[model samples]
Target: MVDPAQILASIKTHPPSCLQATKCSSHYFSVLSGSAKHYMMFSEKICWIGFCLVGSLTHVFATRYESGVLELGIHSLVPGHSITVDDDFVICDVDIEVSFSHGYSSPGDLDVGITFDADSPVTTGLARNHSCGLFGPVHARFDDSSSNTLAVNSNTCVSDGSDVKPDGDLSLFNGHSSQGSWTLSFNPSRGYIQLQQWAVILTPCDDGAGTGDPHFKTWAGKWYDFHGACDLVFLSNPSFAHGTGLDIHIRTKARYQYSFIESAAVRIGEDILEVGEYGGYLVNGISNADLEKLDKYTVTHEKINSKQDVFTIELGAGKQIVVQSFKDLVSVKTVGASLEEYGGSMGLLGEFGSGKWLSRNGTVMSDAIAFGNEWQVLEVEPKLFQTNQFPQHPVQCTMPSTSNVGRRRLGESIAEASAEKVCGHWGDLKDQCVYDVMATGDLELAQAGAF
Candidate 1:
C-alpha cells in the first residue's frame, strides 16, 4: 500500500526546479494539439498493476527533495492545493490506467530524452534496471540512449534480466541499432516473458504542425503511472498543447482519457480500496490523531530579553512575522534597544534563560539577562535574507502575489526574517520538542499552526 501523503512530501522536498527534474509530471502532462483531433491520435499505453493499489490522495507534496533547504521561501501546503483521490473499482487486487495527450503546455523547455544514459534518470528515477535496452548500445544489438535509428525503422528482442551481458560475440555493436527491440530493461535477471514486462513502441510519422501550439521534445525516457502501462506510443501527431501555465483543476469524477494507457481497478485486503481512475492524491486508513500530527512543525528560539513572554518571529528568506503570545501574559516590551542590549546572543525563554550569560572568548555578561515580558516584538531584522534584500507586507493576507494591486503597492519597505533551527545528532528530538511545546497546550488553538 503506497502512502499518498508521503509520496507528495517526497516530491515537495524536491520540487523539480530544473527541466531534468520536472520531466516526470511535466513531460507526462504534454497535452496533444487541439486541432489534431482528426488525423492521428497518439498511441495510448497501458500498464496492469495490482495490490500496490494506493487510493487517491487529496494532496500533493509541499516541496521537492533537495540536499539542503532552499534559500527561497517555501510555499505552504494548506487547503486550496487539493488534488483528487478515487475509490476502488476492482474486486480482488487494485489496478491503474493512465493515458497521455499532446505535449504542449510547457512551463519551460526541457533538455532530456536527448539521450538514454543513467546519468539523468527522469521521473522518480528509482527504477533499478533503467539502462540501455530495447535497442541501445549495451544490448545484443547497439545499446545506447542517444541512438535515433529506432525513430526510423527498427525492432529487437530480449531473453533474460540477469545482470549479465548478452552473448559476448554480439553484445556491443558499434553501428547497429533497431526500430524496436529491448528498448528498456529493468533487471537482466528476470527472464523475458510476454506476461512479465510491458513492451512499448514509438514509430515516427510526421503529421505536420499546428498554428499556435508549443513544441516539446519527445521524452525518450520511460516512466510509469502506477499500472497504466501498455504498448506505449509517442504519436508524432504534429500538433501539441500550447500554454505557459498548465494547471488542470478538476473535481471528483472528472474523467480523463488517453490512448494505449492500460488502467486496472484494484482493492486491497482492507485499507487501500481503489486506484487508476484518479491520481493517488489521498492516503486512506489514517487515524484522525495521526493525521493531525502527520504534517506541520514548530520552532523555538531564545528570547533576547530578560522577562518571560511570548514573542513573534518570522523565519524565512524574506517578509514574514508570525505572532505567538505567551499564556496568561499581556504587557510585552523590547529587551534591547538595538538587538545588542541583552548580551547580543539568543537563548530560549523559560529554560534557556536560566543559563549564565557568557560573552565571546573570555568575556562574560556584566548585566546580561535572558527571558522578558515581550509578546509583540516582530523579528523582521534588517540583516535578513542577506543584508541587502527584502519584501513588503502589511500583516494579513495569505497569497501576497495573488492579492490586489493596492495591497501589493502599499509600499516597498524592507522586511527581513531568518529562522535558525536547533541542531543535534538525534534529528527526531529537535522535531518533537519544537512541535509539542509550541502547541501552546491550548485546546482552542489545537488547529492553529505553531509556525
Candidate 2:
C-alpha cells in the first residue's frame, strides 16, 4: 500500500527538518530477501557484513518524518540528482525511484512497497518484500516505456547500484541458465547504483518433464518483468565485525526465486561515491533466495576495469541454508554548534549520555534521538537564527529582537523551507521522554535556539 513514488517525490520537492535519529535502524537479523525498510543502521547492506553497526553515533542531517507529524526533507545530496526519504513508516528513509528502469525492465508490475524502519538490529531478521533502504526501486518485468524487447519471465528491480549484471549462470551450485543476461548503469545524483540482471521465462524442469526452454513453456507461464535497481552496500571489510549482519544463505536458498546483491560503488575517474554513508550499519535480514552466486568485496571500486566476483550458490529443494551472520553496533551523530546567550547565562543546552540536547554556539543547536523510538528535535528557521544576529547567545531583550523575530518559531508555518532551521528548545531547556507525537504534531516544534 506504500507509494514509492510519493516517497521519492517528497525528497525531490520537499523541505528539510531539524530532527535526529537516536539509534540506527533496528536489525532484523537473518538471511533472506526483505520487505525493504529496516531501522537506519539495521537497514540492509551492513547486515551482510559482520556486525554492521556503527559505534558512538549515526549522524544524519538530523531530520525526522511523520505522517502529518513531520515532513522528510530531500535535497540535492548529490549534484545533478535529488533524493527523498521513504517514510512509509517509522525510522528508515532509503531512496527509491518509480516508473523508472534500466531501458531493459521495470518493477512497477509487482506489488512492491518501500518502508522506513529507522531502527533495525545487526543480527537476525525476517524476509522483506517490496521495501527500500538508502536507495531502492522494486523491479519486476512488466515493461512500460523503458524496455524495448520482451526478454523473459523475470523481475528486474533496480536502484543506486548502476552497473548490474549477473557474473554468469554457471557457479559452484546450480548450472548456469541457457537464457537471461544482466545489465547496468549509474544514477549518482540519487546515490543510486543502478544494476539490471535480465533473463526470460522460467527454466523449471516441471519435475523433470522435459528440457527447459524459455521459448516454449508447457505448464508454466511467461512473465516479462523489469525494474531491478538499488544497491546493497556491504562493508569494506565483512570479516571485521561492525553494524548488523546479513545472512547470505536465505538469498541463494530460494535460488531463482530472488536475487541478493551486496554493495557497489561509483567512480567518476578517481572520485568514488559510496552508496551509503561512510560509517552506516546494515540491518539484519535473510539472504534467502536461489543465488547461483554471492559477490563480495568492492562489487564496484576505484579500479575501472575491475570485474566483480560473485559468490558460489548451492541450490535445490529441501536444502537447509547455513548463513553468515552479523550484528550492528554502529551509531550516527550530527555535527553542530552551540547557542550562547546575550546574558551569558548558566550554560546553554542540555547534555545526554554521549550526545547533547543543548545548542552548541551563539547560533547553532543540536538534537539526537538516541537508540529507540523516534523523537523530533524541532529546528527553527535560519531567519530565526537571524534573531541570534544579536552579537551574543541567549538574547534576552525587554523588546523583541524585531518584528521579523516573531516569525522565527521553530515549528512556525513560515520557517519550514530552509536548510538550517531551529529545533527543540534553545539556550536553557528541559523536556521529557516523548512517547507520542507533539501537541502540534509538527516536527518544526522541536526547533533549536528557541527559548
Candidate 3:
C-alpha cells in the first residue's frame, strides 16, 4: 500500500543527507533526531541519516550476522547524473538486487517497491509479506528470471519462496526509443529496504541497412491529387531495407458513400503486381477516424527495386496516377487513363510529355477531367491535415423564421431575420459567407448585429 503522493511529499519535506562511512563492521549505530528519520542507503550498507518534523513514526532496523555486517555508503543523488543511458539503445530487460535488514517483528512489517519512469510499481518479496525468517539478498528480475539461479551463502540469507514474481515485460519498451530520461524510484511502505545494484540491458535493431546495400537510396516525398475534387493523396516513403511503401490518405466528401482503398500497387520497370491492400472504409465527415487510416495502409513489399525516377501508381479500378521525382522537384499526374494514355515514360531515364495538362506547380490551362469541376491545388505547408481542415457541412438552424411584427421580439431587426434565413440554405458555402460578409462590408453592423 504505497501512496506515490505521500512518498513524494515526505521526500520533499525531509531530504536525506549525503555522507561517507569509513568503517565496515557487524554493528552500526544511527542517531535520528525527529520522529521521521530520512536515510539514504547505498549498496555498501552505509547510510546518511537525517531527521524532519513530519510527525510520522519510522521504524529503524539493525541486524547482525555471525560472519560479518554489510557496509553501504550513502551518496548525494543528482537529478540527471544519477543514471545515463545511450540514446540509440533499446531496453530489453532489467535486473535489480536489493537487501533488507532483518529486524522486523513479522513478515508484513517490510515492503519494498520500485518503479521505472513513474510507471506501475514492481514489488519484492516484502510486498507479499514474505516472512523474513532468513533474508540477506532478494533478487527481482523483469522479463525472464528463469535463467538466474539464486546463490546460497552460509553467512547471507536468500529468499527462495514463491510469494514474489517479476512485475512487467520488456514489451512495455518495445518500439519506443531509449533516449529519454528514465526515472528509477524506490518506495518502502513498512520497513527499511536497501538497493544493492540495478542493470538495464539493451538490444538495438537495424534501422536502414542490414541485408540491403548501405548506399542504396529510395524516394521519399508527398504526392497530392492533381485536382482537389477528392480529398485523397499518396505518400511514398522508404520502409526498412530501402523498400518503397505507398500510403493512401483519403478524405471523403460525402456522407453515406464512404471512401475505401480497395487495393494499391506501384508499377516498377514495366512489371505490375498487387503491392498491398487496406480493405477498410472511412466514413465521410468523421475526420479523426478517416485520418487514422492514412498510416494503416498495407505495404506488401517494403523494398522496391527502383532508382530515383518516375513511377506509375495503379490504385484499384479506373484510377491511376504518376509520380515524377527529379532531385527534390516531386510532381504528380492524376487526370489520365493510364501511364500510356498520359504519355509518361517509366523508370529513371523516362519523362512525361507536357501535353494539354497542368504542371506540378498547379498552373492549369484546362480543368482536369478525372477530378470533378471546382478543383485547385490549395498549397500549404506540406503536412497532414488537421480536423479543422476537413470540409464541414453547414449547420441548418431549425428555429422558426417569423416575419410578423407581433411575433418578432424587441431589438430583433429584419436584416438579422433575413441573414438567418440565408444561413439555412448556405449549405457547404457557409464558411464563404463569413469571408464575403467581411470583404464586401455589405452587412451593416446595426442590421447584421445578431449574425
Best by lDDT: 3
Compose the digit string of candidate 2's lDDT tens values, residues 1-451.
Answer: 3343454455347533323232222221211123332221122111111111121123222234567554333322211111122322111111222222222223222222222112321111111121223333334332112322222234333343332222121111111211221111122222122221211111211110000000011111111111111111111111211322211100001112211111222121222222211222121222223222223222211211112111111222221111111111011111111111001111111221111123323232332212100111113211111012221212221112234333434333333323123333332222210100121233432331110
Task: Write one digit per residue (lDDT tens) for candidate 1, span 1-451.
Answer: 3343454566567654442321222111112242111111111111121001011122122223457643211221111111121211101100111111111112221111111122232121112222232221121212223122222111222223212222111212111122111212222222111111121112111111100000111111111111111111111111111211101101111011111111111111112111111121121332121211111212233332332222222222321222222232111112111111111122111111112222323232333111111111124411111111111222211112333445423432321111113212224333322322222222222121221
- Please give the clash total of every predicted structure, in order: 75, 171, 7
- List runs of model 1 lying over 4 Å from the truth: 1-439
Two-way lDDT contest, 1 vs 2, winner: 2
TM-score of each: 0.15, 0.15, 0.28
Question: Model 2 misses residue 268 by how many Å?
Answer: 54
Model 1 scores what on Cα lDDT? 0.19
Instruction: Give the Å shift of residue 220 in candidate 1.
Output: 28
What number of backbone clashes does candidate 3 have, counting pairs of residues 3 or more apart or in separate chains? Answer: 7
Whole-model Cα lDDT of every candidate shown, in order = 0.19, 0.20, 0.28
lDDT of 1 at 247: 11
Q: Which candidate number maximizes TM-score?
A: 3
